[model samples]
Target: MSKISVTELNKISREIRQDILDMVYTAQSGHIGGSFSSTEIVTALYFSEMRHLDPADPKRADRDRFVLSKGHACPVWYASLCKLGYFEKYHLSSLRKINSILQGHPDMKSTPGIDCTTGSLGHGCAAATGMALEGLMAKDGRRVYSILGDGELNEGVVWETAMAAAKFKLDNLVFFVDKNNLQMDGTSDQIMPLFSIEDKFASFGWNVLTIDGHNMDQILESLKVARNTKGKPTCIVAETVKGKGVSFMEDVRNWHGKAPSKEEFESAMAELTA
Candidate 1:
């Protein structure tokens, strides 16, 4: 991974946001707000960190891996992978189309860089824990990174995985919670009140870090700290907005899984380009 300046990461983020908008608009059916919220975190992981897999050999055992536990937000991950040369940029427009590799949820068999097939919200964390444990058993330096939505934490499986992660002592795995504070129904608090996610993870016996999810420097530094942790998994609570960049989408639940209208798409693209 190249050392990227904050200015450069900011520029890259805009391109990713454009990809998110374009793909969702083209598919006419896909999650929009969550993808936007997660763009920077996915961009930072794929472009500025992670290593050891060529597009041709994404399934290699020694490669660093990433799982989109919040599978519905894969547009951001797909966009980042394309930008990182995992596949041609043109494939991004095929998102959610019939028989497209870019399915509504991530499928590792269909997509080259995806390491796991994840759509059921809380399952990715458990799968990620297993992958990280495999690396530990092999004594491989490879790390596993999994991104989870704050809303997804409402599932019991998330805490089960948290406990298992601590029990296994998976120092090589890093978990990121996209703490956007909203689920499909309403705000997270109204839904289930995950009052202090950071504290909850801390109680699980893992090292925890919190950061502004959109701040490239903080994202980078937290990953650095996580990389250096020993004997316990690390959890990063990334504070984020549901819809990060575009004016109309930010914090708006109506846009959760709705594609922007043609006019809205045009305005979004124009704003991002500016």
Candidate 2:
């Protein structure tokens, strides 16, 4: 696959955001804030960073793997996959419907490109760690990538996985902490004050980098650095605005899991289209 320029990548991110707002509004249930927040991160991977992904041969060995550790933000993932031709665009509308492959969280069995089933807060990162270790043990050069919400760090299991990834020196694993600073309830500080996510990962013995999550240049550069890093795993703390690209939803806690009303949806779509 050819490399995508930063300009093109930004266009794709905006399209994904549109898909997210449309999915949530149509379903009247989904996590929109975090999905919007992490849109660029997911876009960078699927469109620019990761490699060896075939829409037809999603299960091909030696292909890179990605896990949405913050599973509720899966509308972004579904949009990315659909855009990449992992499945038909029609499935995007079926999001969260009963028996739809595009469920509230990812299901590996039903989804063609999903490498893991995830929705339980800290479980996805743990599963990603295991996948990285498996690739390591097999001596395959495959790399595993995952995205974690900053609030998900409150989970003890997340820290546990951090320790294990470091202990094994799983440099093949690279995860991003979506430091959007907001969660379902309120601001992350109001909920569980994660003082310094970068320092936390560094203390866990991982190579750490912080970047503007919405900046395509920064996001692509961090992934390059992570790939070149050796010895320990890399954690990129991506500072982002919740409900990014949408004027009304940005940084608003209420938008975390709420579907936009008809007027709100139209407004969001108009903003994204612009």
Candidate 3:
């Protein structure tokens, strides 16, 4: 796919935010804060950075893979996939419904564009690392990408995967930490202080970059840098607002997994549309 201009990318991100709000409000239950937070990151990858992905051939072997390690934020992933024509747009309203392909968390078996079934927090990063390792062994030249919540960093398994990825020098892997600084409970600092995500990743022997997660240019540029770095996995620490683009929701912990009421939904849609 040809690269989309930053302006166009920003427009897509807004539309995605709208979709997230609509999906969660319609479902009356879904994660909105983290989904909104990671909107631009996921948008940039699906629209500009990833290679060998053909919506027509969702299972193409050479396609770059993306794992949403912070699976509650699957609304962002689902919105992007629907926009890219992975499945019918009608499924957006079916989010979290019984047997819906667009589940609360990702379900690879039912979703066309999902590369992995995730929702177990730190497990998805480990899965992405394994996929990167597999690609290296097979010499398929495929890259694996994943996004993890800063809150999820509390998982010891994430550190385990970090060590393993560095030990094997999995340069084909790139991970983004959605450092929104808020978890389901409270602020990251209040819940579990991760003093420096960048320093932590660097200490784990991975190449690390920190950027404004919501900035389209920084997001695209960081992905480029990740592609060029050699001999180690790359981690991009993206600083972002938890409930981005919505005034009432921004940085508000209650919005983490709560659906907007009709009034709240209207307010959010108006903000996003504006």
Candidate 4:
């Protein structure tokens, strides 16, 4: 209820994680691992780093913008938006349900507070780059942010978008790379090894920062640095475990998009609540 402190953010993170577990378990489908991995980043943005995210003015022009490039992890974004009052909390229960506005991926037209409808891996980058271009061209002070999964980085379009963001000196853009080593398949190294996620972005001429994605202080600090940066885009490559909070699920690739069974769900809830 007060200005959110780190303690409050941690508590909110746990609540959001529990909600994600419940949402995925009830729907019988949804990406919980990635959602859990992104918990602190999303919280730091909505509660601490981002500006003009007042849920009441969901579409305010010049407001800070965000896109979840890794759209399969919509559960975390949805939970944050709900907590921020962008939507009804009860809507969380419908995630991945047939005909639910809460679909398998984020839909800007369907969801409040979603800047871009990103389902395909690399498309979100293009969209976020476009939004940053729009803000820069208009000289609007608003900033644009997006999160890309490390696994999603395998797409060539991501590099293309990165180059475009740098070309225009779109310093208004900030990207958070959720560098969780495991994807829907097995380890990212086993599936598609990406050589130095930070180097790849730096090669594009964007400012780069790497941090432990789960660390509350580091996430907030990187966001502050990103906001102050100018002349090019900023990318925060965050190393995170796939399933961060639950003991059994941490870094487990199988949980990428699989709903937990009743027992696993209960166990996850207990850990998160604890």
Best by lDDT: 3
Off by over 4 Å in 3: none
> What is the lDDT for 140 in model 1?
79
Q: How high is each candidate's TM-score?
A: 0.97, 0.98, 0.99, 0.97
What is the C-alpha lDDT profile of model 2 across 6-63, one tens digit per residue? 9999999999999999999989999999999999999999988787889888888888
Specify the poorest-scoring 10-residue window by lDDT in model 4. 1-10
lDDT of 3: 0.95
Better of 1 and 2 by TM-score: 2
Model 3 C-alpha lDDT per residue in residues 168-219, reported as the tens digit of each score: 9999999999999998888999999999888899999999999999999999
How many steric overlaps does candidate 3 have? 0
State residue 196's C-alpha deviation in candidate 1, in Å: 0.8
Off by over 4 Å in 2: none
Colliding residue pairs in candidate 1: none
Model 4 residue 106 distance off true place after TM-score fit, in angstroms: 0.5
Q: How close is candidate 3 to the true structure, as a TM-score?
A: 0.99
Candidates' C-alpha lDDT: 0.90, 0.93, 0.95, 0.90
- The alpha-carbon deviation from the true structure for residue 62 of candidate 3, after best TM-score superposition, in angstroms, is 0.8
Task: Write one digit per residue (lDDT tens) for candidate 1, span 1-274.
Answer: 6677878888999999999899999989888889888888888888778887578777777888899999999998888888878899889989988888899999888887889999998999889999999999998788999999999998999999999999999999999999988888899899988989889999999999999998988999999999889989999999999888999889998888998888999998999999
